[model samples]
Target: MGKKKASSHKFLALAAAAAIAVPAVSPAAVSAKEHSFKDVPARYTEAVAYLTNNGITKGLSPSQFGTNVSISRVDAAIQLAAALGIDPQGTYKNAGFKDVPKRGQWAVNALAEKGIISGKAAGLFGAYDAITRNETARLISLAYKLTIDETVKKTPFTDVNAQWAKYVDALVKSGVTEGKTSSRFGADDHLQRGEWALFLYRLAHPAAKELDLTIMHTNDTHAHIENAARKVTAIKEVRKAKPNNVLLDAGDVFSGTLYFNEYLGQADLNFMNLVGYDAMTFGNHEFDLGTKPLANFIAKAKFPFVSANVNFTSDENIKGLVTGGIAAAPKDGSVYDAIIKEVDGEKVGIFGLTTAETVDISSPGAGVMFEDYLEKSKKTVASLEKQGVNKIIALTHIGFKDGGGDNDVTLAKEVEGIDIIVGGHSHDLLKEPVLDTTGKEPTVIVQANEYNKYLGTLDVKFDKNGKVIGHAGKLIEIDAKGEDGTYILEDDPEAAEILATEYKPAIDAKKKTVVGKTAVALNGERADVRTKETNLGNLITDGMLEKAKTINKEAVIAVQNGGGIRASINEGDITLDEVLTVMPFGNALAIMNLTGAEIRAALENSVKEVPGQFGGFLQVSGLKFTYDSSKPVGERVKTVEVKKENGYVPLVDTESYVVATNTFTAKGGDGYSTFGKAYEEGRVSEPGFVDWEMFRDYIQANPNAAPELENRITDINQP
Candidate 1:
């Protein structure tokens, strides 16, 4: 437990100035109900003595302390902040709560800023809610950074659960006042004024030094080297503000733009080296080029790669570079596993875990094996704890679990002792770190928006026992609206030069090469394609269908997960670079034979998270479907029809259909297990073409592909 600094001099100074010892009226000074309570001043003698002695609370009148009356949570917050000598009369803005007044906002913000009291959902402080003993105790313990010394005996609370027991124990062991009951804590009872006074007073008495940790991170950067200069500038500013800090990259620093296409991730390596990344993990995209190119990228990368779960023992090209380290991966000359980093005399244990789904989605090759995520996380944390390192940060590529995959939140719940998770792959823009409510200590998980668009900074504070007490963070925007050249960062001259003289000319040349023309603009925005059908979705899926038809005579359908489409094509001439931007993953074509039942199941999967955009949301061609999104998942599809030579007809469940899609989805990339099963059943084949090339070719073949919302897929319930 961390000791707290006491500001008792304020109380002593007040006493000296007043020239008074205790409050003027002692227990014997006046009769109850007469001068104090107006009902029972004599009934609360000791409670009065404790409050006055600690200088925590003053009675309403000169002789009366409102011992029996309930206290509002907000009022309690103000009192506690005051007891800590933090005046909040008018310092903070809104206090991040809607109901709090500007005048009283600072106190609430102070407590919240320290991670003492978390508001109700939607950032509500519940100012007026009556706080029970258990709730109040938890907040107090958090604010004071109190930990139960295992050696100290328990407080024996009858009401609080095992989860709340340790906190209640800390409250009592602090020698703050004993609970309302000797053996049983009245956990559900409303906190009264006198009890509140005793609690705050005790919390303010301990004295100790504070520990601060600053973690700067990035995720899902996807090879945007131009924005790297700005990212470097942001880090320099952060280093100035916090001398003691760790810089980290959360992976996916590969793929997306021509930078990766031409340099094959080496361009990213040059910029990352200039930025001085402490460590990095292999996002699934890192394996897109199979192992040899990945091995080349790893050999040139200056930073260590960490991931305990991904075992790369098979690919001969990288195996020598990885399995036994050989100066290729993390830990100086070791392969890949957990690494211990020493920053400012603190032993910070770091580990990494990519989602196990990487095997099916990317070309990690048959050699690289991904272990179970939760299992690996648990083992790594235990290993760290055994090393006497309490502070642990998991640099993970396993994103926030929005789709049906193992994610940061699930990892937080299942793993113990992880203080922070710097995650990627989901491309979530977390304004603040997400804390794990289930863990013993706070486990913070954070991810910045993808494509080098935002640089995330997380400031964490740790107590004596190395438990995370509080954290604050924000995602810095990568560039100005609609412009890439203009960024918020002054370039690191070396990184800027690498982008300019080395990579820029090639990318610029390719960008100006016109490939095709479109009559109308494409809607490839995340919200549009992921949640609903768009003209761009129709066009891309048609490209896949046209390409698949050339290989297989029976290929009639093309399916593309909205996630595969990255950018919108404007009306007019479309450049090859623009096509690459629209389909950046370098995903290759795969032809699969799936039964209509499996196809319908895939449709059901697409609409499962309706009203919420899931990357797995299907955008298709040669098929039409109607779904009632308001209905429950698995039962949402109301009707499905397949286009035949004569007309569109109902899909036959028993009959198999020839379908084409990117290799990612064909192998069950984004929660599409139905397609994965078909792939595993030997019904899938690679058609020897990349997604962007195929798209360009199809666009060239058809001068003006339809860019209209044809209502191919719609919600039947919508009017």
Candidate 2:
């Protein structure tokens, strides 16, 4: 900001050109002593009217407002100095330059003292030198106190990078100036009086400039497009009322219900495009369909996608999207690290971070690697800072779990300068925002649970320094009334059309088919199923155990992968589509013969990523186990017992046991390689029943079946 140059002649030419092209409506061009002025019919009538009506500028004489003449440098300075209420009646000893006319010496010295302009050369004030566009930008920017660091790789102009980039970038960022052409600044151009008046008028009224950012966010939507219409309506309404409103999704808008099974992620993306999402990050399930499908989805996105980590080099499908560059040197048009968004005169930088666990529980396919979330996050923030962006946001799928590592909480604490985090993956229900002040400033984190039941609304207020000093966040229920008991969400007519014609047809036919009835609300939610025993988990595993018993009566225990259970079912007549939605993978039931020791090892593997939830966690039936997550991997399973004829019995290492699980896990999905080895040894048998079929059978046989935790699984280490 204090940069000094030995010569100002070249810059003066550029500044003069700018001043002439970018006109302001004022009579300053006709000389204060001249009388009649011409009424130029241009777009600046309102500004010129304001100047005349407010006495801010009187015509060069009585009638002429000098509407169409070249404005002199001294006239522009005098107008700006007067608007700022600076008393320029006193004489200055240096007079800013030797050439400053006696009548203008006070205004020139006053403006120079405020750093708005400088002499063209030693002792040469150049007060009469025509002001250029670049000069007008510099002076007005300084008047508004617009600060600039750097956010350009190359100047917008082919000829401007070396000398005029800083001034041009500042003026654009300030909302007071733009290049003569999209790719050229027209630096060596002079200012007409009209152009200079407009600049002066804007500088005079700095209060009109401001930014109010309203963010509508969702996370882990998981193909819950049924309620999407209402959410779309809500977003459109907010946008109608605000200027800088942005719509964002934290991730997992892919799998869960029959919607995803029948149409994959198409339904969600289509709806997202309809709602105009500004950006999105990758959720673990994004890789469940392999990198090719994920790339296809990304290609269809209308907006940019960001993720600081996750190497796309290993997969040919997504390699083209990875515009290779280091994290600190953000590449133009690349969404890998961070993106600078201009929102109503303010620059908001957004970056993304994915969960590292995608490697363990998700089938991202070969050639994909995840980088350290925290490390990449820090680098991205630093890069954004280098780009002159102070308001930074992290769009992450890394969740927020209490007492857990690598979650959003850790991110807020580790990465400084991040203003907010819109997150998902753990499917957390944050009715309000959680503010963490562990860093140099407060970091607000918000996640709107899972599904499309609600839209998260966050309003943040920043001081002039771009520091967030006030914020408010809330969940706006899509179909429910507001706290004041009035419905705030309306159904979008356009969204309804899309849902009926484009997105809902594939699953509509099966969505109504009944499977079985549930007495209690089955809980297969990602956050609960991965960390504890959910009734939905119990119900699914019960079906697997029943089927295994038919195969061998000796099959005493059953276990289902938590990842296989995708959604919860309300207490009612569950439909076949609902069953498929809860268990969408179409995994076949596979029975495995394992010794007690192998079973114990598999159970240990289940809880390996505990406390911080993992999809590999097992939901069991006909068996109960207690574990301490604080213990080492092999030692976490402190005790295990199998249900016997008389009662529960402690596992015997040499005892042969029959267990049931999905084919994917039996083939080592979710790090269950123990079962994989058993399958490879030909000790695993296919039960010939689809997983969802069992879910249907279990609910039919035990109508209104409400399975309880029953102390089947315990975390002894938990406080």
Candidate 3:
């Protein structure tokens, strides 16, 4: 704080504006003597000098500033009035208070007349009582006319009452104080003389500059750690340009490549640690290996996990690691609903929301359950706001504009206070930030595409009130090789070393170790597999059936969701890496006893949205069905037949059949409610044979592993 002029030019101007007439040389000038206080702490030395240099306060004995002594209500009022350029001895209309004494009567009356001070009771001012932090807040706020952030529902302090929160909010927003601690405001505690000096000094020279925050985020990285070195280079470039930046992942750090298959998220976590990720949420695939592996992943995280919608309370492995609600000082290697992060001297609230579909699509097991995304999101935002945090970011794993389930666009439109959404799941490559102006404040939504293709960066400028005033975003390609096949970005040496020394050797060997040979190239393209059944999908289901028959001879029909088939086997030696790449989720085989009618229902669900690329499209073995695109969804299946020794026979709706499929589809993933019903009814049993292993075994046993589609699924309406 700068020393105030001895002439009191600004104070006199404020007095003139308030229409308070006082002697030219004010009471502040009467005791304008600066003395070195031996008792003043080092921290408050400048504030003490500022107060005494401007004659705002005189030492008790001209040497001791009495910094720790509590200032009484009347004494506080006199100082506040003088600081605002009002003379304590000036004539002013009396505020009716029976207990008012003559000593500082005019100062209290002048402040009361101007609505800056108030009486404790109807007819009495607590003149001799020590002023509290709340009272100090109100006094400073009114004296300086600090803008009260009405948006804040709570202050950082737990001790602050509802009535006093607004005033404290004003003080905090104006950069006057950050409470007694990050979690305690000490609202009822007596205001010390040194604290008052600091408050007054800050009020006189307020620093309410706009804060510019940069967010470097990734999503659906899916263990594509081949580009870890490139991503590190991109992240470092942004951090160098914008020192105030946070690196975040929107989830799906697990599943996709052999890295995750072999190391179970450890390789990716190592890269994340190198990149210094600020926080992450869980994606459906994070639970694909069930709770134990996920718990292990959580245990190794160097950064906290924010999972507002995921309930791990019943999971013994994860329950102890979770810290519920908003955490002011979030610890690493833990989980919380939300957290307060201070950046550039401003509090930014960040939380996580995973899709509730995880239970249906992945293997979260019975203990870990997901809550409704919207409800949990609203509560998390409210809790963060209650802790006086206004700048909120929803680091989400929900898809962007996904029509089938919860997504980011709907989140921005429905949630009131969310300022930014860094998203994943649908793997949308948002080249530019999507601005949603539908809410009370503009919310910016951004997503980087899947498999570590790009690193997304968002820069937002927040005004003094914590409202986003401006924003810009872009996707930076984390490409190691350019169009000409030359390395454009140098690899970060440390990250390259980790990959070369720790992971590359095993991954290279796995890629070269051939599992089997494919006579014809299998098609698992998104447009083909998710629409019409592909040979690759058929082969996957056929392998599942071959393995299921060993455990249960009754297993005849095999069905697999097209979504579970990730890649195609080339028309050559199929290596372990290629097999893993195709079935990277590590879905175990499951056999279900379902009535023929339930089978037909599942078939209907599989083809309902087709010709439109539904992920649940069934690639089957031992069954064939005809469906007309023109028919209604529920009635699309025209005919169903079972494969018997004598060839095709009409299906009996009442007869029970043993069906084999991946655990994901059997558990009702991809909107198979019929399968979900069976699983819930205890009619499904998991044989624990992993899908890739089964596929590998099938391919190895039959060297000529050339599986072809034999009209297993026919769209009758089409050619």
lDDT of each model, Cα atoms only? 0.72, 0.72, 0.79
- State every prediction's TM-score relative to the real structure: 0.53, 0.52, 0.56
Order of the predicted models by TM-score, top scorer first: 3, 1, 2
Q: In candidate 3, which residue pairs get closer than 3 Å at backbone N, Cα or C atoms, i.e. clash?
A: none
Off by over 4 Å in 1: 1-210, 323-334, 402-404, 480-487, 512-537, 543-575, 578-622, 625-719
Tens digits of lDDT, candidate 1, 242-283: 977888877777666677777888888877777777888778
State, as a TM-score between 0 and 1, how close model 2 is to the true structure: 0.52
Question: Candidate 2: lDDT over CA atoms?
Answer: 0.72
> lDDT tens digits, residues 470-555, model 2?
88888888879879987567678888888888767767786788767877888989998998888888878888999778756788
Clashing pairs in 1: 4-206, 33-38, 33-39, 325-334, 325-335
Query: Which 10 residues in a row give candidate 1 its minimum summed lDDT?
Result: 11-20
What candidate 2 gets wrong by more than 4 Å, as runs, is 1-211, 324-334, 402-405, 481-488, 511-539, 542-575, 578-719
Distance from true position, residue 610, model 3, in Å?
Answer: 20
Q: Which ten residues in a row have the lowest lDDT in candidate 3?
A: 3-12
Which numbered prediction scores highest in TM-score against the true structure? Answer: 3
CA RMSD for every model? 22.1, 18.8, 17.4
Encode model 3's per-residue lDDT on 1-719: one tens digit a residue.
11111111111011111112322222333222534567788888766765666555676654567789898888787777766656555688889887766667877899999888899999889988999998888888887666777666777788987889889999887788898899898899999988988887666544445789999999888788987888898899999999888888998888766788789999999989878889999887788888788888888889999999999989888999997676655778899887767677566788999887676557888989888998888877766654345678999987776533588888988887788999987666689999988866788999987678888999999876667899999888888578999777779999999999999889887777887898999898878888887899888888888887876788889998888888877798888878878887766566788999999999999898877988888889889999998899898998999888799898889999999987678767898888878766657764435677788889898896788879988999998
**Highest-scoring model, lDDT:** 3
